[model samples]
Target: MLEMYRSYLAACNERAWDTIAEFLHPSVLVNGIPRTREQYVDDIRKTIAVFPDYAWQLRHVVQQPPWLAVHLHATGTRHQDFLGAPGDLSPVETDEFAMYRIADGRIAELWGTADNARLRLSTHNETR
Candidate 1:
């Protein structure tokens, strides 16, 4: 299961948006919010657009039946404003923690947390 999860991350890095169904359930929820597969791909695209050269460095992975928790560090340079909403094109190194609930051998739900305020504050000076 861990290996599958890693492959999913690698696929995201490759921007293989079309292959997501191989890993995720159709009713997947991100942080408890319902998301369609298209929305998931869009979210991945946004992350890729903002951090074009980022790497998902894994810190730890622990798996118990039906659940996997991953601690990761997403470090990279920001190439553009993020979210197409509000963000800065400044360097960023954020720690992200995620938990996946697995069902029927696919990811059923995901709850992820990442630190963003530090990045925002780091770029605040540049924008000012």
Candidate 2:
């Protein structure tokens, strides 16, 4: 299971959404928001479109039967306009955490949160 998580993260870092299909169920929930497989992939795709170098580095993981909690440090550089701001901004880094329910060796559902305030601050600082 841990290996699965690692594989998933590696795929995510590479922006290889197709490779991630093996790790995610067809129907997954992210932060209680139901998302189809395509939708989930598109969400990340949109993010990468704004920050071409977006990456997530795992900080920690806690495994309890049927559940895996993850802590990660997310980093990216603004390469295009996003959230009303222009591109070429400084790099962005934020803390992110998620709890995922594993079913049949795939990620069935997840609830995750990121330090949005800090992310916004990065943008604010970059603009000034």
Candidate 3:
């Protein structure tokens, strides 16, 4: 499972959308809300559109059977307006924590949160 997770993260960092669905269940739940795998992938597409250089770096992980807890550091430069922030802003850095529920060797559910305050501040920073 750990090796699978590493491959998943690598695929994400490489923007390898073609292989992403292989790691996700056809139906996934995020934050308690059910979503199709396509919907989940679309959300990622939107983010990448806004931050073309965005990348997620794995910092830590703990896997115990069907449950996995992950810590990631994400960074990206704002190339377009997003969430009330102007475009061409400085790089935005954020930390995200994610909990995943694995079912049938695929990611079936996820609960995650990021340091949005810091991300917003970086995006809206005037000094940039």
Candidate 4:
């Protein structure tokens, strides 16, 4: 199961959405973001466009029946426009953690958290 997560991350880092699809269930729910498979793929593509050098460093993995929690640090430069904001303002490094429900050896659902305060500060230069 940990290997599956690793492979998924590797595919994501490589912008290989097709490879990612291979490890996800047809009904996969990513980070509680209600998107279909195609939408999910598009989201990833947009993310990579915004953070071209985005890299994920897996910190820890905990596996249990029907679930896996993954802690990771995602860091990258904001090199392109993202979410209606311009890019190249500065590099942003954020820590993110995700908990996933695995079913039939594939990712079925996911919930995630990130350094939102840091992201906001880096995105708009405002402290919250």
Highest TM-score model number: 3
Q: For candidate 1, what is the lDDT? A: 0.76
Show pairs that collide, candidate 2. none
Q: Write the per-residue lDDT of candidate 2 for residues 14-77, one digit (tens) a residue.
A: 9888987768899999888888888888988988888788899999999996999999999888
Better model by TM-score, 1 or 3? 3
Per-model TM-score versus the true fold: 0.82, 0.88, 0.90, 0.82
TM-score of 1: 0.82
Each model's lDDT comes to 0.76, 0.84, 0.84, 0.76
Between which residue pairs do clashes occur in model 1? none
lDDT of 4 by residue, 1-128 (tens): 88888888999988888988877777677766565666767777876777788788999888886889888888777877655545765667778888988888887888887774454336345454
lDDT of model 2 at position 23: 83
Q: Candidate 2: minimum summed lDDT over ten consecutive residues — where?
A: 119-128
Model 1 bad stretches (over 4 Å):
82-89, 121-128
What is the Å distance of residue 64 in model 2 from its true position? 0.6
Q: State the lDDT of candidate 3 residue by residue for 1-128, as single tens digits.
A: 77888898888878888677789999999999998888888888888888888899999999988999999999998778876767765689888999999989899999999876665557445353
lDDT of candidate 2 vs native? 0.84
